[model samples]
Target: MEADLPHLVAFMLGTGVRIGEALAVHWHEVDLEAGTVEITHTIARVRGEGLIRKVTKSRAGERLLHLPNWALAVLRARHAAGILNDPVFADTRGGYRDPSNTRRALRTALSPVGNTARRDLGLSLRTLRRETGMTRKQVANHLNWPQNRVELVETGRIKVDHELVRTLVATYNVDLEQFHGLLAQIHDAVQPAESDKLAWIRSHALRKTTATALDQAGHTARQIADQLGQAKVSITQDIYMGRQSANPAAAQALEHAFDDPDLL
Candidate 1:
């Protein structure tokens, strides 16, 4: 009963439900009959305070997200358990879900996919965000939420959109349109990389040291990750190591990294 975190997290990410929104979801918020989820609130806990239910982060936070077929199936499986009206994600006490526990669960679930460590997890999350590239404010705006609250829903940060689905199809060359409205029927897939990961390996020393050189060259974490075949969290670790010296083309690389979508 407590072991489905990975699938659940992947479903939430696919749905763009933000961590807080995901935790706050209730059976009532999920309209199984309509195949939608109404995001109405978020869970938060500030320093010195225990967890509390709060209005969603922004006006954009309150939204009606049409669940993808995969999301719908996951929801259906949960609903079939007959716990309607209960918090969709309850805690140890079967009360409101704890955000920390939920995050831990998500990390735990992502373990087999190389996200077990904190650095690796951060890298994975940043990779997701960069791939999406929608800002926290943009996500909030779409969700009808306050800009400030956008950060809390980091996992489910962006609102689901057709663009994402289209990207999935186009980038992966999957004939998803043939499936019509049955999005859940499609198998999970990943897009192919355009560049050679080996190129970065040949250009840099250790994968761990590449980020520092790039950072000293004034590259952003995103840029370094994109160019070095590493993740932003890994780049941050290199920067933290304090042994990085500026490399040639660091500034130029940073400036132009985003110009080429193919590089990513």
Candidate 2:
């Protein structure tokens, strides 16, 4: 993950910025001396419009944010060698990084983190999809499944069954050897021991973790919401900060409250 993504994921976690917002940030927007970054633009893919840079989702999202020291250091080093007009995080061609490309990069980077079998299978499927220039919907249509089903399988949310494997093999025109290799990976990933490590890790988990940490550290919900560019504190509280238990004993308390000798 470190080698493939470099500092991109870390930058997003440290700042609690959305992936699009982080990708759209330019070197000129970073103030190393002030330890601040101006949140101005975000990258979005509009239907029939392609990738476009637009103002943030809301007025609150346009506010400037103070950077953490580590985030500041990253920008400082980049500023020392990077061009002002270029994106802080650039594509291979040294232009704005597309959010889709970033997601693909993340999937590749995380391929080795846990459950090697699942990761390998997911990466292989994703690679074939990209090579064929087929969208998830296109693949789903070919396989007679919903787009989310194709997405879930590729993201490791759904297990790769034999039927899906055969469909993918036929859809992508994989040879006999490749089919066998994929089958082997699917079999390995479904082993009881490997199942425990098969959890899917989404990129948004970083943002949620950051928000939860801030909430635990006594930052106001509104403050965290602002930093995350959320239009409402309720949104941040309900979504990001809700991932963890605010009080660990709440579960025990509920158990005790519902305790009944007859039921037991």
What lDDT does each candidate get?
0.49, 0.66
TM-score of each: 0.41, 0.62
lDDT of 1 at 194: 28
| Root-mean-square deviation per candidate | 23.3, 11.4
TM-score of structure candidate 2 = 0.62
The residue ranges of model 2 lying beyond 4 angstroms of the native Cα positions read 1-4, 81-85, 113-141, 145-187, 192-199, 234-264
Residues 1-264, model 2: lDDT tens digits: 332255676577666788899889987787777666788899888899888889997776786776665555656766676534467787766777778878765754444333567667778788888998889998888878855667656766455667666778678787636567777887876644344342354578768866766676666666676777777767646556533212222223223332343421
Backbone clash pairs for candidate 2 read: none
Model 1's lDDT to the true fold? 0.49
